[model samples]
Target: MLTVSIWIASSFMGLALLLNLYRLLRGPDIPDRIVALDTAYVNALSLLVLFGIQQGSRAYFEIALLMGMVGFVGTAMLAKYLLRGDIIE
Candidate 1:
């Protein structure tokens, strides 16, 4: 059933999110932490979209889209800062 599938998918995504959180906390290097953070953002986005599908809500989808855009920008800024030691040059 659709409900069962959504539950299973969400469970996997949740597990992945947890692992990403662990990596973000324990990463050995800045780049590793950045990658983990970006992956965590993606996993969170997937979870949000899955929840939206399960709830049959349009608002959740819009929120997820906005989050996705913000996440991308945040990741980009972090990478830029890592490379140049400043976000704005």
Candidate 2:
């Protein structure tokens, strides 16, 4: 049962990730690309968490956490750059 649920969730996450990738590549505007990138990271994070749960592994959790932090910072910087044309003021 648990394995079945994990497989279902993984499939959905994979679909979302692919959509985000398409948006990132073909976005008509910078903001659109940024939003797509942000969602992609979030989806990736969820996938990592799901994998960790399925495998009963602690290491994947740490990796997911690390990526979450980095993704947040990167997204913030990108937004700032889009707004002010410079990430650091």
Candidate 3:
């Protein structure tokens, strides 16, 4: 059933988010942590979209889109900072 599939998918995404959190906290280097953070956001977005599908609402999808945009910007800023020691040149 579609409901069952959504539940399974959401569980997997939750697990992925947890793993990403662990990596973000335990990463040995800045780059690794940054990557983890980015992945976490993506997983979170997936979870939100799945939730939206389950609830049959468009609000969660919109929120997920906004989160994705913010996540991208955050990741870019982190990468830039890592390379130049500052986000803004």
Candidate 4:
């Protein structure tokens, strides 16, 4: 039952990933691309958590946490750059 749920979640995540990838590739505006990238990172994070649970590996969770932090920082910095044209004031 748990395995089935994980598989179903993973499948939906995969579909979301594809859609986000398309947006990232074909977005008409910079903000749209940024949003797509953020979504991709979030979906990737969820997938990592699910994979960690499936594999019973604490390391995967640690990595996922790190990725989430990095993704958040990166997105913030990118947004700052887009808004102010500079990452650092």
lDDT of 1 by residue, 1-89 (tens): 99999999999999999999999999999999999999999999999999999999999999999999999999999999999999987
**Which residue segments of model 1 deviate by more than 4 Å?**
none
1-89 in candidate 4: lDDT tens per residue? 99999999999999999999999999999999999999999999999999999999999999999999999999999999998999987
lDDT of 3 by residue, 1-89 (tens): 99999999999999999999999999999999999999999999999999999999999999999999999999999999999999876
Clashing pairs in 1: none
The alpha-carbon deviation from the true structure for residue 68 of candidate 1, after best TM-score superposition, in angstroms, is 0.6
| TM-score of model number 3 | 0.97
The TM-score that candidate 4 achieves is 0.97
TM-score (C-alpha) between model 1 and the true structure: 0.98
Give the Å error, residue 39, model 2: 0.2
Going through the candidates in the order shown, the clash numbers are 0, 0, 0, 0
Q: Let me know the TM-score candidate 2 reaches against the reference structure.
A: 0.96
Worst 10 residues of 4 by lDDT: 80-89
- Alpha carbon lDDT of each predicted model: 0.97, 0.97, 0.95, 0.96
Per-candidate alpha-carbon RMSD to the true structure: 0.5, 0.7, 0.6, 0.6
Q: After TM-score superposition, what is the CA distance of residue 15 in candidate 4 from its true location, in Å?
A: 0.4
For candidate 3, what's the RMSD?
Answer: 0.6
lDDT of 2 by residue, 1-89 (tens): 99999999999999999999999999999999999999999999999999999999999999999999999999999999999998777
